[model samples]
Target: MKYKVFVAGSGGIGEAAALLLREWCEFETEIFLGDVSEENLAKAKNFILQNSQKTSVVETILMSKDGTNEAMKSAFESCACLLDCSPGTQAPRMARFACDFKMHYANLTEYVAETDEVIALAKDAETGFVLQTGLAPGFINVLAMSLYRKFVEQFENETIEKVGMKVGALTAHAHQPHFYGFTWSPIGVATEYVKPSRVVRDYEIRQIPALSDRETIIIGGRTYEADLTSGGAADLPDYFRHKAK
Candidate 1:
């Protein structure tokens, strides 16, 4: 059976995800790439077609800046799942469409306010709603929890001294003055730098300013600076509150 998947946003992440779904998904998939820019939509469609399998179908829908386009709504209503790779600020709107369309909703936004709104909206939703499902908050959080569980089982200890997690999407070469290139959204990077981070310290969940505590570390013979960032903690601080530091 062919499942229709709607991807709202034709940016880098959305294009890559749509291509992956078209090529590697378990079942046959018909993907619709929606974006406010026709150029981006065309580019995304071409990229997907170049990399997709013959059995998969790729379509495009021209979305409005406000996300109120009737064509976009029709596309959403026809899909089985809505993968939102748009900006964090737009997460709530995309999630609302998902809930109303009764489609599984997943988003890659780490904006706490928008995520909270989606959580409230999806609390009673029959369809599944996944939020902040990107690199840091998504995979790293799960990896940390798994390692924590293994540590407890292996050492027969209920608590540990400290749990620290760091992730970076850096380019091969670094220049001076913020030695980072734009691998992801620059707005997202700015948000991480400015927002307050939630972390467990001294066996308690505490809020601290991002980039407050910077440390130098060497990985694979390369040195890099690391610091606290928001939206990467996931639910660890909440789960580990009063459990471990």
Candidate 2:
């Protein structure tokens, strides 16, 4: 169905998502881009307008941090879905708006506490509320489950030694002090590094401190260091507690 989408953040991810929706969506789409920064909103609007193959009605709204303004209310009430590309810290706020407006909510945040807050806010909501729909926690987790299901069907065995899921966000070049460079949100990297990780150990669900377990591994004839990080495993550790080691 043709519908309106409200993009909560106008930063890198938000802008890209808006552009993709306009360019790739088969159905006609009306997009409302909202952000606290006017410059970001302008840039995002220009990028989508210039790059999209299909013509769409794109509007930009200057949203308050708390989303209490009249413009925010009008946009929230109008859209069918709220695609939250804001920072992890703004997850619950965005989810709350979606729930109140009876709109579908989706976000790409790995912050554990914020995710939990969204869960609580959306537990009784009628509309769909999807959280952590990002690369590491979202796509990687789904891929692991798909592989596990395939393994059980092919081998006729649910028991497995281990299902290791690893993902790394790296830059082409590095600098002094910290070797990693950010192509995305730096807050996400910091939060995942400090927060506790949800993992399955000894066929039981456990919360282990992030980065506590570190090891060296070789992949594609290259050496790299890996560690436990928060939210990367998603809920696989819980769903496969006894089924996988």
* Best-performing candidate as measured by lDDT: 2
Q: How does each model score on TM-score?
A: 0.93, 0.94
lDDT of each: 0.87, 0.89
Residues 1-245 of candidate 1 have per-residue lDDT tens digits of 89999998999889999999899877889999988899999999998888765656788999888747788778877899999999899988898888888999998887777787989999988899887788888888888889999999999987788888888777889887877787678898899889998888888888999999999999999998999988887777888888776
- Per-prediction RMSD in angstroms? 1.8, 1.5
- State the displacement of the C-alpha of residue 129, model 1, in Å, after optimal TM-score superposition: 1.2
lDDT of 2: 0.89
Q: Where does candidate 1 have its weakest 10-residue lDDT segment?
A: 50-59
Error at 13, model 2, angstroms: 0.9
What is the clash count for each candidate, in the order shown? Answer: 0, 0
lDDT of model 1 at position 199: 82
Off by over 4 Å in 2: none
